[model samples]
Target: MRSGIVAIVGRPNVGKSSLLNALVGQKVSITAPKPQTTRHRIQGVLHGDNAQIVFVDTPGMHRAAKKALNKAMNDAASNSLHYVDLALFVIEAGRWTDEDEAVLERLKSVKSPVALVINKVDKFSDKNDLLPLMEKLAPLREWAFVMPLSALKGANVNVLAKQLMERMPEGPPLYPEGQVVGHDLSFTISEMVREKLMRSLAQELPYALTVETEAVEREGGLLKASAIIWVERDGQKKIVIGEDGAMLKRVGTAARRELEEMTGGKVFLKLWVRVKEGWTDDPKALSRFGYEGG
Candidate 1:
Protein backbone atom coordinates (compact mmCIF):
# COMPACT_ATOMS: atom_id res chain seq x y z
CA MET A 1 0.00 0.00 0.00
CA ARG A 2 1.06 3.55 -0.57
CA SER A 3 1.11 6.06 2.28
CA GLY A 4 2.51 9.54 2.80
CA ILE A 5 1.77 13.11 3.90
CA VAL A 6 0.45 15.66 1.38
CA ALA A 7 0.68 19.32 2.37
CA ILE A 8 -2.12 21.49 0.93
CA VAL A 9 -0.50 24.89 0.65
CA GLY A 10 -2.13 27.99 -0.78
CA ARG A 11 -3.55 31.45 -0.19
CA PRO A 12 -6.66 32.00 1.90
CA ASN A 13 -10.20 31.16 0.74
CA VAL A 14 -8.86 29.15 -2.20
CA GLY A 15 -10.88 26.11 -1.15
CA LYS A 16 -7.98 24.45 0.63
CA SER A 17 -10.25 23.34 3.45
CA SER A 18 -12.96 22.40 0.97
CA LEU A 19 -10.44 20.21 -0.83
CA LEU A 20 -9.49 18.56 2.45
CA ASN A 21 -13.11 17.80 3.26
CA ALA A 22 -13.64 16.45 -0.25
CA LEU A 23 -10.59 14.21 -0.06
CA VAL A 24 -11.62 12.76 3.29
CA GLY A 25 -15.36 12.87 2.57
CA GLN A 26 -15.89 14.39 6.00
CA LYS A 27 -15.53 17.66 7.86
CA VAL A 28 -12.19 17.03 9.54
CA SER A 29 -11.22 20.68 9.32
CA ILE A 30 -12.91 24.06 9.81
CA THR A 31 -13.47 26.31 6.78
CA ALA A 32 -14.26 30.01 6.41
CA PRO A 33 -14.16 32.74 3.78
CA LYS A 34 -12.11 34.83 6.13
CA PRO A 35 -8.36 34.82 5.69
CA GLN A 36 -6.21 32.96 8.22
CA THR A 37 -9.22 30.96 9.33
CA THR A 38 -6.94 28.02 10.03
CA ARG A 39 -4.44 28.70 12.78
CA HIS A 40 -3.19 25.15 13.35
CA ARG A 41 -1.96 22.24 11.28
CA ILE A 42 -4.88 19.83 11.00
CA GLN A 43 -4.13 16.37 9.63
CA GLY A 44 -6.99 14.74 7.73
CA VAL A 45 -6.63 11.06 6.84
CA LEU A 46 -8.00 9.83 3.52
CA HIS A 47 -8.33 6.02 3.42
CA GLY A 48 -8.66 4.09 0.21
CA ASP A 49 -8.89 0.32 -0.28
CA ASN A 50 -5.15 -0.15 0.16
CA ALA A 51 -3.64 3.32 0.36
CA GLN A 52 -3.99 6.05 3.00
CA ILE A 53 -3.26 9.71 2.39
CA VAL A 54 -2.60 12.00 5.34
CA PHE A 55 -3.45 15.57 4.32
CA VAL A 56 -1.88 18.39 6.29
CA ASP A 57 -4.19 21.39 6.01
CA THR A 58 -2.23 24.47 6.93
CA PRO A 59 -2.93 28.16 7.58
CA GLY A 60 -2.65 30.47 4.59
CA MET A 61 0.79 31.91 3.81
CA HIS A 62 1.00 35.69 3.79
CA ARG A 63 3.12 38.55 5.00
CA ALA A 64 2.24 39.05 8.65
CA ALA A 65 2.35 41.95 11.01
CA LYS A 66 5.21 42.11 13.53
CA LYS A 67 3.02 40.30 16.03
CA ALA A 68 4.49 37.02 17.23
CA LEU A 69 1.24 35.15 16.68
CA ASN A 70 0.96 36.17 13.05
CA LYS A 71 4.58 35.22 12.43
CA ALA A 72 4.05 31.80 13.98
CA MET A 73 0.96 31.06 11.88
CA ASN A 74 2.80 32.11 8.68
CA ASP A 75 5.84 30.04 9.65
CA ALA A 76 3.74 26.96 10.33
CA ALA A 77 2.39 27.07 6.78
CA SER A 78 5.89 27.18 5.29
CA ASN A 79 7.43 24.72 7.76
CA SER A 80 4.92 22.06 6.64
CA LEU A 81 6.84 21.78 3.35
CA HIS A 82 10.12 20.80 5.01
CA TYR A 83 9.39 17.06 5.28
CA VAL A 84 6.47 16.02 3.09
CA ASP A 85 6.26 13.40 0.37
CA LEU A 86 4.34 15.76 -1.87
CA ALA A 87 3.08 19.32 -1.82
CA LEU A 88 -0.40 19.93 -3.27
CA PHE A 89 0.19 23.50 -4.37
CA VAL A 90 -3.38 24.76 -4.77
CA ILE A 91 -4.26 27.84 -6.83
CA GLU A 92 -7.51 29.39 -8.02
CA ALA A 93 -8.09 28.70 -11.70
CA GLY A 94 -10.45 31.65 -12.23
CA ARG A 95 -7.68 34.16 -11.60
CA TRP A 96 -3.94 34.51 -11.99
CA THR A 97 -1.89 37.08 -10.10
CA ASP A 98 1.69 37.90 -9.16
CA GLU A 99 1.04 36.44 -5.73
CA ASP A 100 0.63 33.03 -7.32
CA GLU A 101 4.03 33.31 -8.94
CA ALA A 102 5.51 34.50 -5.66
CA VAL A 103 4.08 31.46 -3.93
CA LEU A 104 5.63 29.22 -6.58
CA GLU A 105 8.99 30.93 -6.23
CA ARG A 106 8.99 30.49 -2.46
CA LEU A 107 8.22 26.78 -2.72
CA LYS A 108 11.12 26.11 -5.12
CA SER A 109 13.47 25.43 -2.22
CA VAL A 110 11.63 22.23 -1.36
CA LYS A 111 13.29 19.11 -2.74
CA SER A 112 10.12 17.01 -2.87
CA PRO A 113 7.96 16.87 -5.95
CA VAL A 114 5.20 19.49 -6.27
CA ALA A 115 1.79 18.98 -7.87
CA LEU A 116 0.08 22.11 -9.12
CA VAL A 117 -3.58 21.45 -8.35
CA ILE A 118 -5.65 24.24 -9.89
CA ASN A 119 -8.86 24.52 -7.89
CA LYS A 120 -12.24 26.21 -8.63
CA VAL A 121 -12.33 24.94 -12.19
CA ASP A 122 -16.11 24.88 -11.97
CA LYS A 123 -16.07 28.67 -12.18
CA PHE A 124 -14.83 28.49 -15.75
CA SER A 125 -17.59 28.67 -18.33
CA ASP A 126 -15.92 26.18 -20.62
CA LYS A 127 -12.67 24.28 -21.08
CA ASN A 128 -11.45 27.11 -23.27
CA ASP A 129 -11.78 29.56 -20.36
CA LEU A 130 -9.25 27.46 -18.45
CA LEU A 131 -6.63 27.82 -21.18
CA PRO A 132 -5.48 31.18 -19.92
CA LEU A 133 -4.93 29.82 -16.43
CA MET A 134 -2.93 26.92 -17.83
CA GLU A 135 -0.96 29.32 -19.97
CA LYS A 136 -0.02 31.44 -16.97
CA LEU A 137 1.24 28.35 -15.13
CA ALA A 138 3.24 27.12 -18.13
CA PRO A 139 6.48 28.25 -16.50
CA LEU A 140 6.18 25.45 -13.96
CA ARG A 141 6.91 22.75 -16.52
CA GLU A 142 8.84 20.75 -13.92
CA TRP A 143 5.83 20.37 -11.63
CA ALA A 144 4.95 16.71 -11.00
CA PHE A 145 1.49 17.36 -12.47
CA VAL A 146 -0.78 20.25 -13.43
CA MET A 147 -4.28 19.18 -12.46
CA PRO A 148 -7.61 21.03 -12.61
CA LEU A 149 -10.28 20.28 -10.07
CA SER A 150 -13.26 21.80 -8.28
CA ALA A 151 -12.98 21.12 -4.59
CA LEU A 152 -16.43 22.55 -4.05
CA LYS A 153 -17.87 20.22 -6.66
CA GLY A 154 -15.57 17.24 -5.98
CA ALA A 155 -14.68 17.18 -9.65
CA ASN A 156 -11.44 15.40 -10.50
CA VAL A 157 -10.58 14.85 -6.83
CA ASN A 158 -10.07 11.17 -7.48
CA VAL A 159 -7.65 12.07 -10.23
CA LEU A 160 -5.65 14.20 -7.82
CA ALA A 161 -5.81 11.41 -5.24
CA LYS A 162 -4.42 8.93 -7.75
CA GLN A 163 -1.61 11.33 -8.60
CA LEU A 164 -0.81 11.77 -4.90
CA MET A 165 -0.56 8.02 -4.46
CA GLU A 166 1.84 7.83 -7.35
CA ARG A 167 4.01 10.48 -5.72
CA MET A 168 4.21 8.60 -2.40
CA PRO A 169 6.30 5.53 -1.60
CA GLU A 170 4.79 2.21 -0.64
CA GLY A 171 4.26 1.93 3.09
CA PRO A 172 1.78 1.00 5.79
CA PRO A 173 -1.04 3.33 6.73
CA LEU A 174 0.10 6.12 9.03
CA TYR A 175 -3.09 5.91 11.10
CA PRO A 176 -5.66 3.25 11.90
CA GLU A 177 -8.62 2.65 9.62
CA GLY A 178 -11.14 4.32 11.93
CA GLN A 179 -8.85 7.20 12.74
CA VAL A 180 -9.54 9.95 10.21
CA VAL A 181 -8.09 13.03 11.90
CA GLY A 182 -5.21 14.23 14.09
CA HIS A 183 -6.84 17.08 16.06
CA ASP A 184 -7.61 16.28 19.66
CA LEU A 185 -11.30 15.66 20.29
CA SER A 186 -11.51 18.69 22.53
CA PHE A 187 -9.59 20.81 20.03
CA THR A 188 -11.89 19.78 17.23
CA ILE A 189 -14.93 20.67 19.24
CA SER A 190 -13.46 24.06 20.06
CA GLU A 191 -12.71 24.75 16.42
CA MET A 192 -16.22 23.83 15.45
CA VAL A 193 -17.55 26.27 18.00
CA ARG A 194 -15.24 28.90 16.59
CA GLU A 195 -16.51 28.23 13.10
CA LYS A 196 -20.07 28.65 14.29
CA LEU A 197 -19.18 31.88 15.99
CA MET A 198 -17.39 33.08 12.91
CA ARG A 199 -20.48 32.46 10.85
CA SER A 200 -22.74 34.22 13.32
CA LEU A 201 -20.59 37.19 14.22
CA ALA A 202 -19.61 40.29 12.29
CA GLN A 203 -16.34 41.22 10.66
CA GLU A 204 -13.33 41.59 12.98
CA LEU A 205 -15.32 40.00 15.78
CA PRO A 206 -14.50 36.50 14.62
CA TYR A 207 -10.81 37.22 14.40
CA ALA A 208 -10.81 38.92 17.79
CA LEU A 209 -12.60 35.97 19.30
CA THR A 210 -10.89 32.73 20.36
CA VAL A 211 -12.69 29.63 21.52
CA GLU A 212 -11.37 27.18 24.11
CA THR A 213 -12.96 24.03 25.45
CA GLU A 214 -12.54 24.62 29.13
CA ALA A 215 -14.05 21.46 30.60
CA VAL A 216 -15.34 18.19 29.23
CA GLU A 217 -16.63 15.38 31.35
CA ARG A 218 -18.69 12.27 31.03
CA GLU A 219 -21.94 12.42 32.99
CA GLY A 220 -23.89 9.21 32.80
CA GLY A 221 -25.54 9.10 29.36
CA LEU A 222 -24.48 12.58 28.28
CA LEU A 223 -21.31 14.62 27.82
CA LYS A 224 -20.74 17.88 29.67
CA ALA A 225 -18.71 20.59 27.95
CA SER A 226 -17.79 24.13 28.89
CA ALA A 227 -16.10 26.65 26.58
CA ILE A 228 -14.50 30.03 27.08
CA ILE A 229 -14.79 32.76 24.49
CA TRP A 230 -11.79 35.00 24.83
CA VAL A 231 -11.98 38.56 23.63
CA GLU A 232 -9.48 41.38 23.74
CA ARG A 233 -11.74 44.00 25.22
CA ASP A 234 -14.64 44.27 27.62
CA GLY A 235 -16.91 45.81 24.99
CA GLN A 236 -16.35 42.85 22.70
CA LYS A 237 -17.19 40.48 25.50
CA LYS A 238 -20.48 42.27 26.09
CA ILE A 239 -21.24 42.18 22.38
CA VAL A 240 -20.75 38.41 22.22
CA ILE A 241 -23.11 37.93 25.13
CA GLY A 242 -25.84 40.07 23.53
CA GLU A 243 -28.95 41.42 25.27
CA ASP A 244 -30.54 39.10 27.84
CA GLY A 245 -27.73 36.62 27.14
CA ALA A 246 -29.31 35.64 23.81
CA MET A 247 -26.09 35.41 21.87
CA LEU A 248 -24.23 33.24 24.39
CA LYS A 249 -27.27 31.00 24.58
CA ARG A 250 -27.25 30.68 20.82
CA VAL A 251 -23.56 29.84 20.77
CA GLY A 252 -24.04 27.20 23.45
CA THR A 253 -26.96 25.59 21.65
CA ALA A 254 -25.03 25.48 18.38
CA ALA A 255 -21.92 24.00 19.98
CA ARG A 256 -23.93 21.36 21.82
CA ARG A 257 -25.62 20.30 18.62
CA GLU A 258 -22.23 19.74 16.95
CA LEU A 259 -20.79 18.03 20.02
CA GLU A 260 -23.74 15.62 20.08
CA GLU A 261 -23.13 14.80 16.43
CA MET A 262 -19.43 14.23 17.03
CA THR A 263 -19.75 12.17 20.24
CA GLY A 264 -22.95 10.34 19.30
CA GLY A 265 -24.53 11.39 22.57
CA LYS A 266 -26.39 14.31 24.04
CA VAL A 267 -24.23 17.23 25.13
CA PHE A 268 -24.76 19.82 27.85
CA LEU A 269 -22.75 22.80 26.69
CA LYS A 270 -21.87 25.93 28.66
CA LEU A 271 -20.23 29.01 27.13
CA TRP A 272 -18.57 31.93 28.87
CA VAL A 273 -17.02 35.06 27.45
CA ARG A 274 -13.94 36.58 29.09
CA VAL A 275 -11.85 39.60 28.31
CA LYS A 276 -8.10 39.24 28.05
CA GLU A 277 -6.62 42.51 26.92
CA GLY A 278 -4.47 42.19 23.80
CA TRP A 279 -4.36 38.43 24.20
CA THR A 280 -3.33 38.08 20.58
CA ASP A 281 -0.08 39.88 21.29
CA ASP A 282 0.52 38.60 24.77
CA PRO A 283 3.18 35.87 24.83
CA LYS A 284 1.53 34.00 27.67
CA ALA A 285 -1.85 34.31 26.01
CA LEU A 286 -0.42 33.10 22.69
CA SER A 287 0.95 29.97 24.35
CA ARG A 288 -2.39 29.37 26.04
CA PHE A 289 -4.10 29.64 22.66
CA GLY A 290 -1.67 27.03 21.14
CA TYR A 291 0.25 29.45 18.95
CA GLU A 292 3.68 27.92 19.29
CA GLY A 293 7.01 28.30 17.43
CA GLY A 294 6.93 32.07 17.87
Candidate 2:
Protein backbone atom coordinates (compact mmCIF):
# COMPACT_ATOMS: atom_id res chain seq x y z
CA MET A 1 0.00 0.00 0.00
CA ARG A 2 1.15 3.55 -0.64
CA SER A 3 1.78 5.32 2.68
CA GLY A 4 4.07 8.17 3.71
CA ILE A 5 4.28 11.43 5.61
CA VAL A 6 3.28 14.74 4.04
CA ALA A 7 3.79 18.11 5.75
CA ILE A 8 1.38 21.00 5.18
CA VAL A 9 3.34 24.27 5.39
CA GLY A 10 2.12 27.76 4.79
CA ARG A 11 1.66 31.28 6.15
CA PRO A 12 -0.98 31.78 8.86
CA ASN A 13 -4.68 31.64 7.84
CA VAL A 14 -3.87 30.16 4.41
CA GLY A 15 -6.17 27.19 5.29
CA LYS A 16 -3.56 24.51 6.08
CA SER A 17 -5.56 23.09 9.00
CA SER A 18 -8.73 23.30 6.95
CA LEU A 19 -7.04 21.39 4.14
CA LEU A 20 -5.92 18.67 6.54
CA ASN A 21 -9.46 18.30 7.87
CA ALA A 22 -10.83 18.31 4.35
CA LEU A 23 -8.39 15.62 3.24
CA VAL A 24 -8.95 13.42 6.25
CA GLY A 25 -12.71 14.19 6.48
CA GLN A 26 -12.26 14.88 10.19
CA LYS A 27 -11.02 17.57 12.51
CA VAL A 28 -7.50 16.68 13.55
CA SER A 29 -6.45 20.24 14.26
CA ILE A 30 -8.32 23.16 15.80
CA THR A 31 -8.54 26.34 13.75
CA ALA A 32 -9.48 30.00 14.31
CA PRO A 33 -9.40 33.18 12.24
CA LYS A 34 -6.38 34.42 14.15
CA PRO A 35 -2.84 33.85 13.01
CA GLN A 36 -0.69 31.16 14.71
CA THR A 37 -3.80 29.30 15.92
CA THR A 38 -1.83 26.12 15.41
CA ARG A 39 1.24 25.83 17.63
CA HIS A 40 2.05 22.12 17.39
CA ARG A 41 2.62 19.53 14.65
CA ILE A 42 -0.82 17.91 14.28
CA GLN A 43 -1.07 14.66 12.31
CA GLY A 44 -4.20 13.89 10.22
CA VAL A 45 -4.43 10.42 8.69
CA LEU A 46 -6.32 9.62 5.48
CA HIS A 47 -7.11 5.97 4.73
CA GLY A 48 -7.98 4.78 1.26
CA ASP A 49 -8.73 1.32 -0.16
CA ASN A 50 -5.13 0.69 -1.19
CA ALA A 51 -3.23 3.56 0.37
CA GLN A 52 -2.94 5.71 3.48
CA ILE A 53 -1.59 9.25 3.72
CA VAL A 54 -0.39 10.85 6.93
CA PHE A 55 -0.62 14.63 6.69
CA VAL A 56 1.24 16.70 9.29
CA ASP A 57 -0.28 20.11 9.86
CA THR A 58 2.44 22.47 11.05
CA PRO A 59 2.21 25.87 12.66
CA GLY A 60 1.97 28.73 10.20
CA MET A 61 5.36 30.10 9.16
CA HIS A 62 5.68 33.69 10.30
CA ARG A 63 8.39 36.19 11.21
CA ALA A 64 9.09 35.66 14.89
CA ALA A 65 10.41 38.00 17.52
CA LYS A 66 12.87 36.88 20.21
CA LYS A 67 10.04 35.27 22.17
CA ALA A 68 10.66 31.65 23.18
CA LEU A 69 7.15 30.45 22.26
CA ASN A 70 7.30 32.16 18.91
CA LYS A 71 10.65 30.57 18.15
CA ALA A 72 9.33 27.18 19.13
CA MET A 73 6.35 27.52 16.78
CA ASN A 74 8.67 28.60 13.95
CA ASP A 75 11.00 25.69 14.65
CA ALA A 76 8.10 23.25 14.68
CA ALA A 77 7.05 24.40 11.19
CA SER A 78 10.57 24.36 9.74
CA ASN A 79 11.29 20.96 11.28
CA SER A 80 8.18 19.46 9.66
CA LEU A 81 9.63 20.24 6.21
CA HIS A 82 12.68 18.09 6.96
CA TYR A 83 11.04 14.84 8.16
CA VAL A 84 8.21 14.44 5.66
CA ASP A 85 8.35 12.44 2.40
CA LEU A 86 6.36 15.18 0.71
CA ALA A 87 5.53 18.78 1.60
CA LEU A 88 2.39 20.66 0.58
CA PHE A 89 3.26 24.34 0.29
CA VAL A 90 -0.17 25.99 0.81
CA ILE A 91 -0.84 29.59 -0.13
CA GLU A 92 -3.89 31.78 -0.68
CA ALA A 93 -5.02 31.85 -4.26
CA GLY A 94 -4.02 35.04 -6.11
CA ARG A 95 -1.99 36.23 -3.13
CA TRP A 96 1.69 36.04 -2.25
CA THR A 97 3.57 37.75 0.54
CA ASP A 98 7.05 37.82 2.06
CA GLU A 99 5.96 35.23 4.63
CA ASP A 100 5.09 32.90 1.74
CA GLU A 101 8.54 33.56 0.26
CA ALA A 102 10.08 32.88 3.64
CA VAL A 103 8.32 29.51 3.80
CA LEU A 104 9.52 28.68 0.28
CA GLU A 105 13.10 29.53 1.31
CA ARG A 106 12.89 27.03 4.16
CA LEU A 107 11.61 24.35 1.76
CA LYS A 108 14.58 24.81 -0.55
CA SER A 109 16.94 22.72 1.61
CA VAL A 110 14.50 19.87 2.27
CA LYS A 111 14.95 16.69 0.23
CA SER A 112 11.23 16.00 -0.09
CA PRO A 113 9.24 16.93 -3.19
CA VAL A 114 7.20 20.11 -2.59
CA ALA A 115 3.66 20.41 -3.96
CA LEU A 116 2.39 23.95 -4.35
CA VAL A 117 -1.21 24.00 -3.07
CA ILE A 118 -3.14 27.11 -4.00
CA ASN A 119 -5.98 27.25 -1.45
CA LYS A 120 -9.14 29.43 -1.21
CA VAL A 121 -9.74 29.52 -4.96
CA ASP A 122 -13.49 29.79 -4.43
CA LYS A 123 -12.93 33.48 -3.76
CA PHE A 124 -11.50 34.00 -7.23
CA SER A 125 -13.98 35.67 -9.57
CA ASP A 126 -12.15 34.79 -12.74
CA LYS A 127 -10.91 31.21 -13.06
CA ASN A 128 -8.68 32.10 -15.99
CA ASP A 129 -6.51 34.30 -13.75
CA LEU A 130 -5.12 31.19 -12.06
CA LEU A 131 -2.89 30.46 -15.07
CA PRO A 132 -0.98 33.70 -14.60
CA LEU A 133 -0.75 33.16 -10.85
CA MET A 134 0.58 29.66 -11.40
CA GLU A 135 3.04 30.97 -13.97
CA LYS A 136 4.26 33.65 -11.58
CA LEU A 137 4.74 31.17 -8.72
CA ALA A 138 6.39 28.36 -10.76
CA PRO A 139 9.49 30.47 -11.52
CA LEU A 140 10.35 30.63 -7.81
CA ARG A 141 10.51 26.86 -7.28
CA GLU A 142 10.17 23.68 -9.30
CA TRP A 143 6.96 22.44 -7.67
CA ALA A 144 6.09 18.76 -8.00
CA PHE A 145 2.44 19.75 -8.51
CA VAL A 146 0.54 23.04 -8.48
CA MET A 147 -3.05 22.51 -7.37
CA PRO A 148 -5.62 25.29 -6.94
CA LEU A 149 -8.52 24.36 -4.70
CA SER A 150 -10.68 25.64 -1.87
CA ALA A 151 -10.12 23.85 1.38
CA LEU A 152 -13.18 25.48 2.97
CA LYS A 153 -15.63 24.71 0.16
CA GLY A 154 -14.19 21.23 -0.49
CA ALA A 155 -13.77 22.21 -4.13
CA ASN A 156 -11.13 20.11 -5.89
CA VAL A 157 -9.95 18.80 -2.50
CA ASN A 158 -10.56 15.19 -3.51
CA VAL A 159 -8.35 15.66 -6.57
CA LEU A 160 -5.60 17.06 -4.33
CA ALA A 161 -5.94 14.04 -2.02
CA LYS A 162 -5.70 11.60 -4.94
CA GLN A 163 -2.54 13.27 -6.19
CA LEU A 164 -0.92 13.12 -2.77
CA MET A 165 -1.93 9.50 -2.28
CA GLU A 166 -0.33 8.55 -5.63
CA ARG A 167 2.93 10.16 -4.46
CA MET A 168 3.08 8.03 -1.29
CA PRO A 169 5.81 5.42 -1.12
CA GLU A 170 4.99 1.72 -1.03
CA GLY A 171 4.93 0.76 2.66
CA PRO A 172 2.68 -0.29 5.53
CA PRO A 173 0.30 2.36 6.85
CA LEU A 174 1.85 4.53 9.53
CA TYR A 175 -1.45 4.53 11.42
CA PRO A 176 -4.34 2.08 11.50
CA GLU A 177 -7.18 2.38 8.96
CA GLY A 178 -9.76 3.47 11.56
CA GLN A 179 -7.41 5.96 13.21
CA VAL A 180 -7.75 9.45 11.80
CA VAL A 181 -5.41 11.48 14.03
CA GLY A 182 -2.37 11.26 16.31
CA HIS A 183 -3.41 13.55 19.15
CA ASP A 184 -4.72 12.06 22.37
CA LEU A 185 -8.37 12.38 23.40
CA SER A 186 -7.65 14.77 26.26
CA PHE A 187 -5.41 16.91 24.06
CA THR A 188 -8.01 17.21 21.30
CA ILE A 189 -10.73 17.93 23.82
CA SER A 190 -8.74 20.72 25.40
CA GLU A 191 -8.06 22.06 21.94
CA MET A 192 -11.78 22.11 21.28
CA VAL A 193 -12.28 24.14 24.44
CA ARG A 194 -9.52 26.50 23.38
CA GLU A 195 -11.04 26.87 19.94
CA LYS A 196 -14.41 27.88 21.36
CA LEU A 197 -12.78 30.22 23.88
CA MET A 198 -10.65 31.79 21.17
CA ARG A 199 -13.62 32.38 18.95
CA SER A 200 -15.61 33.90 21.81
CA LEU A 201 -12.99 36.38 22.95
CA ALA A 202 -11.55 39.56 21.48
CA GLN A 203 -8.39 39.76 19.42
CA GLU A 204 -5.92 40.07 22.30
CA LEU A 205 -7.31 37.36 24.59
CA PRO A 206 -6.73 34.46 22.22
CA TYR A 207 -2.96 34.96 22.25
CA ALA A 208 -2.79 35.52 25.98
CA LEU A 209 -4.78 32.41 26.84
CA THR A 210 -4.17 28.68 26.47
CA VAL A 211 -6.29 25.76 27.63
CA GLU A 212 -5.24 22.50 29.27
CA THR A 213 -7.45 19.61 30.28
CA GLU A 214 -6.89 18.86 33.94
CA ALA A 215 -8.93 15.72 34.28
CA VAL A 216 -11.32 13.46 32.38
CA GLU A 217 -13.38 10.99 34.31
CA ARG A 218 -16.10 8.67 33.12
CA GLU A 219 -19.24 8.90 35.25
CA GLY A 220 -21.49 6.19 33.89
CA GLY A 221 -22.33 7.27 30.35
CA LEU A 222 -21.18 10.90 30.66
CA LEU A 223 -17.61 12.17 30.53
CA LYS A 224 -16.80 14.74 33.19
CA ALA A 225 -13.86 16.88 32.04
CA SER A 226 -12.20 19.79 33.78
CA ALA A 227 -10.03 22.28 31.91
CA ILE A 228 -7.94 25.26 32.95
CA ILE A 229 -7.66 28.35 30.79
CA TRP A 230 -4.41 30.21 31.37
CA VAL A 231 -4.15 33.89 30.68
CA GLU A 232 -1.18 36.25 30.99
CA ARG A 233 -2.83 38.76 33.31
CA ASP A 234 -5.56 39.00 35.88
CA GLY A 235 -7.36 41.57 33.75
CA GLN A 236 -7.47 39.13 30.87
CA LYS A 237 -8.83 36.53 33.22
CA LYS A 238 -11.52 38.92 34.36
CA ILE A 239 -12.39 39.65 30.77
CA VAL A 240 -12.64 35.99 29.97
CA ILE A 241 -14.87 35.36 32.92
CA GLY A 242 -17.03 38.39 32.08
CA GLU A 243 -19.68 39.94 34.36
CA ASP A 244 -21.30 37.22 36.46
CA GLY A 245 -19.07 34.82 34.56
CA ALA A 246 -21.33 34.98 31.52
CA MET A 247 -18.52 34.82 28.96
CA LEU A 248 -16.99 31.74 30.49
CA LYS A 249 -20.43 30.14 30.68
CA ARG A 250 -21.08 30.77 27.02
CA VAL A 251 -17.62 29.53 26.00
CA GLY A 252 -17.99 26.43 28.15
CA THR A 253 -21.45 25.67 26.73
CA ALA A 254 -20.23 25.97 23.16
CA ALA A 255 -17.16 23.86 23.90
CA ARG A 256 -19.12 21.18 25.72
CA ARG A 257 -21.59 20.82 22.88
CA GLU A 258 -18.81 20.39 20.34
CA LEU A 259 -16.94 17.98 22.61
CA GLU A 260 -20.08 15.90 23.03
CA GLU A 261 -20.52 15.69 19.28
CA MET A 262 -16.84 14.86 18.75
CA THR A 263 -16.69 12.13 21.38
CA GLY A 264 -20.24 10.91 20.81
CA GLY A 265 -21.15 11.21 24.47
CA LYS A 266 -22.54 13.65 26.96
CA VAL A 267 -19.83 15.89 28.49
CA PHE A 268 -19.81 17.66 31.82
CA LEU A 269 -17.25 20.41 31.27
CA LYS A 270 -15.80 22.72 33.91
CA LEU A 271 -13.53 25.61 32.97
CA TRP A 272 -11.37 27.82 35.18
CA VAL A 273 -9.48 30.92 34.13
CA ARG A 274 -6.14 31.67 35.78
CA VAL A 275 -3.40 34.22 35.26
CA LYS A 276 0.22 33.29 34.54
CA GLU A 277 2.32 36.28 33.63
CA GLY A 278 4.85 36.08 30.81
CA TRP A 279 4.07 32.45 30.09
CA THR A 280 4.37 32.92 26.35
CA ASP A 281 7.97 34.16 26.53
CA ASP A 282 9.09 31.67 29.17
CA PRO A 283 10.44 28.47 27.71
CA LYS A 284 9.52 26.31 30.70
CA ALA A 285 5.97 27.63 30.76
CA LEU A 286 5.65 27.23 27.03
CA SER A 287 6.76 23.61 27.32
CA ARG A 288 4.16 23.04 30.01
CA PHE A 289 1.58 24.23 27.50
CA GLY A 290 2.93 21.78 24.85
CA TYR A 291 4.93 24.30 22.85
CA GLU A 292 8.25 22.55 23.42
CA GLY A 293 11.12 23.55 21.17
CA GLY A 294 11.93 21.50 18.11
Alpha-carbon TM-score of each model against the true structure: 0.94, 0.97
Best by lDDT: 2
- Record all residue pairs in model 2 with backbone atoms less than 3 Å apart, i.e. clashing: none
* Model 2 ranges off by over 4 Å: none
The per-model lDDT (C-alpha) reads 0.84, 0.89
Poorest stretch of ten by lDDT in candidate 1: 61-70
**What are the root-mean-square deviations of the candidates from the true structure over C-alphas?**
1.6, 1.1
Model 1 TM-score (2 dp)? 0.94
Deviation from native of the Cα of residue 53 in model 1, angstroms: 1.2
The lDDT of model 2 is 0.89
What TM-score would candidate 2 get against the native?
0.97
Backbone clashes counted, model 2: 0
Model 1 over residues 242-288: C-alpha lDDT tens digits?
A: 99999888877887787788778988888889998888877788888
